[model samples]
Target: MRIGQPGRPLDARKDELILQAGRELLLRGGPLALTMEAVARASGVSKATLYRRWPHREALLEALVLREAQPLLSMLEGTPTDDAGLAAKLEAFLDSMLALMGQPGYRAYLQAIVALPQQQADLQRIWWLGPHQTMESVAALLRRYAAAQGRRWPAAARDAETLIGMAIGLEQARILYRQRPWRADARLRRRLIRAVVASFLGRRSAGIAVCEGNVGRG
Candidate 1:
C-alpha cells in the first residue's frame, strides 16, 4: 500500500488498509468502478488522505497489478531432476496459471488493463511489470530446468512458452466469449503435455544428455 507518493509518509497501518480497500474494489468491480472517493469510503480514510497518497485511479490500479504478479515468480520451484519431473512441473505450472486466469477477478482486472489506451503510462507499467514479467520468468525457468538435466534449454523453452500460451489462450477465450469452464479431460491434458514435450525432444533442441535412458516420444 505504498500508494503513488514515496515522499509523503503515512502510517503503515493506514497504508495497509488503503491498499486492502483498493485491492478489493479493483478485484471485485473492475477498474471503471475503482475511484479514489470510493476507496476512501471503503477504507474509512478521508478523501484528503486518499488523494494525498493515490492521486488517480491509474496509480492505484498499477500498484494492485504489481502485487498480484509478484507471486508468479516462484512457480518454477521443485522441478524434477529427470524428464518426468520436468513434465510434471510443467503440468502443475500450467494448471496453476490456468486457475489464476479463470478467476473472475483476474479476468476482469486483465480485461480492464488491456483495454486502456495505449498511451496510458500506468497501464503500460502494469503490463510490463505483471504478465510480461511472468512470461519472461517462465521462459527463463524452462531454459534453466532443461539445462540442469543436461538438455538444451532453448527449444524446450520455446515449447514451454507455446504450451503455456496455449493453455492461457484457451482459458482467456473461454472467459471472453463462451464463459465456459476450461475443463480439460484426462486425454486432452495428456495430449497437450506430451505434444509440447515431444516437440522439444523431437527437435533435439533440449540438449538432453541421456537420450537412451529417459522416456521416448510416441
Candidate 2:
C-alpha cells in the first residue's frame, strides 16, 4: 500500500508493479540495466506514471529495496516456540537468508545501493530502515522464542546478535573478497541451530565461546 510520508497518495498497484519490474530488471542484468523506460515496458505501465510516483532513480531503487525486504518480513510473521518446531523454523530462516544473500540478485542489489549518490537522508534511511530494521526483526524473534522456552533474552542476546553478525559478515566476505560458493550444508546448518539453542540454555557444549569478562561472545 502507498503509505506516503509527505506527498500525495500514490497508486499502490502501480507502485507495486513498478517495483516488481525494477527488481526483475536488476536481477537479470544488474543495476546498469535498470532504466525507467525498461521498467515501464516490462510492467506495461506508462513512464509518466512511474515518474509521478518516484520522480528520480534513487527513489525507485529505495522502493525496490522495500519490496525486497517484504518477503523477508513475511517469513518471520509466524514462528513456533517448541524446541523441535523452533529449530526447524530457525533453520529454514537461516537457509533461506543464506541463499537469498548469496544470490547474484542480492549482490547486485547491494552494489546498486552502495553506488547511489551520497545524500544524507537517503544514507540514514539505508542504514536505519534497511539493515537495522531487518536486524531488529530477527532479534525480536529470538527474544520471543527464548522467553517462550523459559529463558531470559538479555542473558543470550549478545551471543545471538554476534551470531547474526557472523553469518552476515561471512556472507559479505563471500560477495566482496572471496568468490567461493556459500555452502549451506545440512550438518552445518543443524549445528548452528543447535548452537543457538545451547547458548540460550547456558550449556558450554562443543562450540567456540570467547568469554569477554563474564560475557560470552560467540
Candidate 3:
C-alpha cells in the first residue's frame, strides 16, 4: 500500500495546494518551470508529500491540466435534440475551447507535450484525452443533428475534425504566427464562433470565412 493508496486516502487540501502551485508555476514560466521541487516550495508541501502524489513533473502537470479540462468536457454532456439545442452544444464546445486557449499556460502545456520524448508516449496520450474526447462528442452531435434533418453526413467525423482544427488555428495563430491571439477582442471571437456554428449547421453566415469541403483537410 502506498501513502495515498485506497487504504490511506489522500488529503484534498494538499492536492489543491499542489495543483494551484503547479498552475502558477507552469503559467509563470511554462512547463520547464514546473519542477516538483519548485512546487514543493510554492505549495508549502514537503518534497516527500509531493512525490507521493505524483512521481514526476510530467505527472504533476498532467493532473493540473486535466482538472481544468474537466469543465470543458462536461460542457458537451446532456441531450441536444433540436437544431437550437445542437447549436447550443456546438457553441458551448467552442466557448469552452476559447476559455482553454485564452490561458497562456495552455499553449505552454502544448509545447511541453510536443517536446516529450518519443518513449514518454503516455504523457502525450493522457493529455490528449480532452481534445480527442471532445472531438468524439462533436462528431456524435453532428451525426445526431444530420439524422434529424433527414440527411446522411458520411463526413460528420471528418467535419468535426475540421471544426476542431479551425478552432485551434483560430486561437493558436498568435503562437504559430506573430498575429493576434483570441483575446484581441470579444467582438472578433463572437464573430468567429458564430461563423463556426453557422458553418457546421450548414447555414452560411455573412462574409465570414467558412471551412469549405476538404479544402484544408490534411
List candidate 2 segments past 4 Å from native: 1-16, 25-38, 51-62, 149-151, 155-157, 184-218
Clashes of each: 5, 0, 0
In candidate 1, what are the lDDT values of residues 94-187, reduced to their tens digit?
6666656656577677676667666767656666777677777777767777667775554554665665676655666777675765544445
Clashing pairs in 3: none
Clashes of 1: 5
**lDDT tens per residue, model 2, 84-196:** 66555555565666667667566666676567665645566556655666667767776677667565456344654565664555657677654764544556655664565
In TM-score terms, candidate 2 sits at 0.64
Ranking by lDDT: 3, 1, 2
For model 1, give the 10-residue run with minimal summed lDDT.
204-213
In terms of lDDT, the best-performing candidate is 3
> Candidate 3 at residue 57, lDDT?
81
Q: What is candidate 2's CA lDDT for residue 128?
A: 62
Weakest lDDT window of 10 consecutive positions for candidate 2: 204-213
The local lDDT score (0 to 100) that residue 16 gets in candidate 1 is: 77
- For lDDT, candidate 1 versus 2, the one ahead is 1
